[model samples]
Target chain A: MKQYDVVVIGAGPAGLAAACEAYQNGAGKILVVERDKEPGGILNQCIHNGFGLHYFKEELTGPEYAGRFIEMLNNTNAELMLDTMVLAVTEDRKISMINPRDGYFTVQAGAVVLAMGCRERTRGAIGIPGTRPAGVFTAGAAQRYVNIEGYMVGKKVVILGSGDIGLIMARRMTLEGAKVAACVELMPYSNGLNRNIVQCLNDYGIPLYLSHTITEIRGKRRVEGVVVSRVDGGGKPVPGTERFFDCDTVLLSVGLIPENELSRSAGIALDPRTKGPVVYENMETSIPGIFASGNVVHVHDLVDFVTAESQRAGAAAADFCRRKEQPGGEPAVAIESGENVGCTVPQHIRPDRIDQYAEVFFRVGRVFSNSEIEVASGGRVLSVFKREHMAPGEMERIVIPKKFLENASGGAVTVSAKEAKEN
Target chain B: MTHLICIICPKGCHLNVDEQNGYAVTGNGCPRGAEYGKKELTNPTRVLTSTVKIKGGLHRRCPVKTDRAIPKGLMFDAMKLLNGVELSAPVRRGDVVLADLLGTGANLVVTKSM
Candidate 1:
């Protein structure tokens, strides 16, 4: 069996960044496996720009962003295995992979990095009461057809969710001469970025029905129309508020779930909230020497965040491969989200681990204004962050300095938000 | 007064620009917001990113974007301008398909080759 110092799965932004960083961090032999035919995973289909604003300091299209990383990877020593599907990963860092070119192969790795991104929520997952119609397609699927495949899915559309991809598609469809009837979002607020809402919907005069959902899709052969109605806070459809949109298609942008079948098969501990593996500060999973990052760990709002986090995972994996096994010290402190916060990544932090600081990313359950987010450890306050506005759609981040974590009471750290008092 | 939300960052600061007072801005979080507020009301611009019809390549459509942000009001027209573009394979990234986009100096350049 072939052995490598590091093996990164999925050649998307996450995988590309991880492998590049791993090679840069002194990993002698690294292999990156990608299921896609090309190195640029979903980014190839995502032709629209508005990416790399933070990482590259310049707004770039999806393919452009991935291209830069692929260029960076060309300079590194990491070997890429494209069109290869990772079947399973064992607890011992052995990956079983197969491809059309290569029948099957197994390789043992000193460290494994899981960078497989997330998948979109399908119509079946959301249980939209619709007939088996031809015009039904996931937002991403339709995006692939229009952008990459150069095929039009429908002439008229009614999008079910206000997801960023969905919003971008609305504009794309309009530009292609498709009339978007309405965008029905179950949540009152949009799941997309503020810029998307302005550029896609508000600018195009597309009516956004907030707190509304599609109750029934009226179609026998193809999607002819859909029945939409307003929903209360409890998510129950209101009868009188029923409305209909005569359209040919319905694009679902509901939600995304972490693609973690391989991670689950690896016997790694999974976080119920993030649907990804629970890991230490170094992104090392429950299984030693195995690490995870990007959307596979948690659904990140920004690809820039995915790149940054993957770099850490890559460096950590390289560091793990270089260092000899030793007796571990100090139980890691579990980080918990307190009031108003949803879930915090890096569920646990090992203070003894070498690091400058851990940047924790999370989102709030509800919107708040003039709020102060406080971090506490063992009932003692650690840090306080003030925010002008907080929304569930936007992911929030905070830094836990090494000094604060090292001197902690060895108890779990909790982060909570509260309304700021007027002086 | 023209109300707009600053999209420069995640902050999404809401700004109210008084057109009567030379677009005096309010409710901005930073200086960027102030600039965005003034430009948005006076002359709004956005970078146009989409695909042009491609032939004899791996993909049928090659992604392209304006070299720089052009007038927001000109986006629909710019897209119409792109609709007429049909290129064969061998197109390189940053290859300008159309120069002087709507006379805005923002050239429409291909972001990906095939």
Candidate 2:
């Protein structure tokens, strides 16, 4: 059995950044295991730009962003294991893994970081009423086929769900000489970034149908066409509002759920809202000495946020390895999502573990203009952050100053978004 | 007035460009938005990204992008140029595949090394 101070899973953006940060933070004998043949993970197929604007302060493509981190990891002494899959992770920090060369092996890790990332929701997950068709694919699958495999997925397409991936693929398929008929979304508002909507859909003269969904997919062996219908406020299809589209492919980009089977096997407490592990301010999971970050913790819109979050997990894992014991800290103050807020990361925070402030990341339940985020404790307002615009598609962050946390009288803090008052 | 969303960054500031007033822009959070609003209505451009054929490499396709934004009207022509391109392995990032694409003053360069 091999032994390591820290073991990071999935050599994607999260794993790559975490391993490098761990190495730099005085963690010795660190190991990064990846199931893919290459090191960049999903970024290898995401060849689009608009990444690394916040982290590197320069605009870079997905592969370029991952390449920079891979280069950084190559300069470190941390070992990387490619073409390897982790089977199970025991609560004791024992990782069971398999590879062609290594066969089946186990490694003892002082601390573990879960960064397996997330997977795209498939047609089966959404239960789309359609014949088993060959031309239907998830937006991400089409992306891999076109960008990496050099294969065009379709000629005439009707895309369901206007997430970022679907919007991007709409342009990509068009650039490849394919005709994208329409991008349909169930929600009244798009789930993707505003920039994507303008650049990918509006730029190409493609129509976007909001509050609409595919009622039926008409095809036998291959995708032939689809029937789209408007949905009411309750998301039920409105009768006599169906429109048919003649197409060859239907791309689904509904949502992404974090891959956390290994974490569940380790008996880690999972958060229903995030479908990831419940974590502390330091990214430590319910199990001591085990941490998680990146999309494995929650699906992030931007890769830059993943890098920042994973670096914190990496640094914390390194500290855990060095201490070799869980340090006693003050009681954790739980975080609650209030009105208009969907969810909050780092479900709780310990005063002693935090530095000057604790950063809380969240998303709104709906869109609002001239809004203010209020952080309250014990029925008293601690702080308020103003925003010109707030939307469910964009993630928001607020920092709780240490002084405010010290002044909190309640055992938990509530964060909410409300319309700003007119002066 | 022409309305446009600034794609300069993720902020996506909505700008109203007054074409009659020398293309002055409002509702912009930054100078980039103002410039973008002005240019978008006059001569729109975009940074095109796509993949091309590759041989003797780890993957069959190599991702590439234009070094700068090209005229939006020339996007399809720029993509057509890649259809005839096929590169061998050992290609490095930032290596130019085509220079001054369609006279747009932007070079097509490889984004990922293969």
Candidate 3:
């Protein structure tokens, strides 16, 4: 058994960023454990651009974005364990890890950062009734195979979701000389960025069918075709609207669930809303000294935000371990979604810290134009900003001034959107 | 009439524009239709990614990408410039493969090391 001042699990972008922060913040001994042979995590397989626009003020591909932090980590005092899978973590911050290279190890930590990230939702999880065929693949799996392994999944394909991965895969398959029959989306609007809809589909001349779903996946040993249908307003399939397309593969990108089995086994309270560990303003979970960030906290569209969030989590963990004073005493108020808004993270906000301003990230449920997003508490609007347009595919955030929280007497704080009244 | 194409989704709308009549668009489903139409009529843009030649490394080629979004009109030219380049090994990821390629203000970044 070895002891470390800070231990970060899963060396993805979040974990890498967190480990660097912890070490920089004066953690004596730091260890980063990654299950993969390499440390970049999912970013290694994400070969496309559109990351780092906010954090680095430039666009970068996934690997390039993640590599920036990895370079930083190399210069720090952090130690890394590759090919190591952390099996469990106790509420007391004890970790159990298995590495074929390092064998089994158990250690207690002054602080633990859970950056295991999230997992892609599979066919069984979504309950798409279909034959257990061989050609079915998740968008991420396909991305890894094509981008990293340099092998094509199939020649003709029909993707099942319009999530960012599925959309990007559609273009990827087409560019690699495969015929993408169509990109079927269950929702009325796409769950990807507008830029993706353009670059990944429209530019490639692939079709996107909205309010539609793959009712049945038809295949035996391999996918032969799929049954698609139009969905009703309530998101259920309408009878007689079925259509069939012969294809060789089915890609599922329905959604991502934060991987928290270890967190759950540790008896940490999970937030049902985010499907992640409930974290406070500092990204610390209900269990003290154990922090969580990145996709494990809640799925984020941009890797830039993930890096930024993890920095805070890492700094907070280092402070926890060092017994140093932190920016505390802000009672968090729950942030609820209203109208066209979806869910918000750090669900609770510290009213007392309002003077320090906080960056709130969220998603819109649908596409709308000329909208006013109002952050309110107790029915009184705290701040309002006008957005030219908002989409479900893009992650939206607002930096609320610290004064807004200082002015609030403490009631339910919610972020809601309303159509901007005609000027 | 400046014909504009809306590439917002798979539903590509070929928009007909009459510059004299303030550009009334004919084939747009969403407001983005109008936005794309206007942008196409003015400055079309796209993000470009490819590879660059590196020195002192393991593999023959290292994958390079754009550090920012570039104009669409400069895309094909950008790819042509990036395709012919090569880099040496030991080229760390995020290193600048080509700084300000063709003067679009977008730097080409290294994505994968060779």
Q: For residues B8-102, write the lDDT of model 1, one tens digit per residue.
A: 76557889999999889999988988998999888888788888898998878899999888888888898898889999999888899999998
Q: Provide all candidates' interface root-mean-square deviations.
A: 1.6, 0.7, 5.8
Give all candidates' CA lDDT scores.
Answer: 0.89, 0.93, 0.81
Q: Which ranges of candidate 1 are over 4 A from the true structure?
A: A326-329
Docking model 1 quality class: medium
What TM-score fits each model?
0.97, 0.99, 0.83
Instruction: State the lDDT at A412 in candidate 3.
Output: 59
Sort by lDDT, best first: what order? 2, 1, 3
**Residue A365's C-alpha lDDT in candidate 3?**
72
Per-candidate count of clashing residue pairs (backbone under 3 Å): 0, 0, 20
1 or 2, greater by lDDT: 2
lDDT of 1 by residue, A1-423 (tens): 999999999999999999999998999999999998789889898888878989998878999999899999989878999889999999988999999987999999999999999999998898988677889889999999998888989999999999898999999898888999999999988888887888889888999999999999998899899999999999999889987899999999999999999999889999999899998888989998999999999988888999999999999999999999743766788889899888888888887785688788888988788998999988899999999988888889999987788777756789998898798
Candidate 2 chain B lowest-lDDT run of ten = B2-11
Off by over 4 Å in 2: none
Question: A1-423 in candidate 2: lDDT tens per residue?
Answer: 899999999999999999999998999999999999889889999988899989998889998999899999999999999999999999999999999997999999999999999999998898878688789999999999999988999999999999999999999999999999999999999999899999999999999999999999998989999999999999999999999999999999999999999999999999999899999998999999999999999999999999999999999999999994678666888889999997799898888899899999999999899999999998998889999999888999899987777777867899999999898
Ranking by TM-score: 2, 1, 3
Task: Kindly indicate the candidate among 1 and 2 with the higher DockQ.
Answer: 2
Q: When only chain A is evaluated, what TM-score does every model earn? A: 0.98, 0.99, 0.94
What is the overall TM-score of model 2 with all chains considered together?
Answer: 0.99
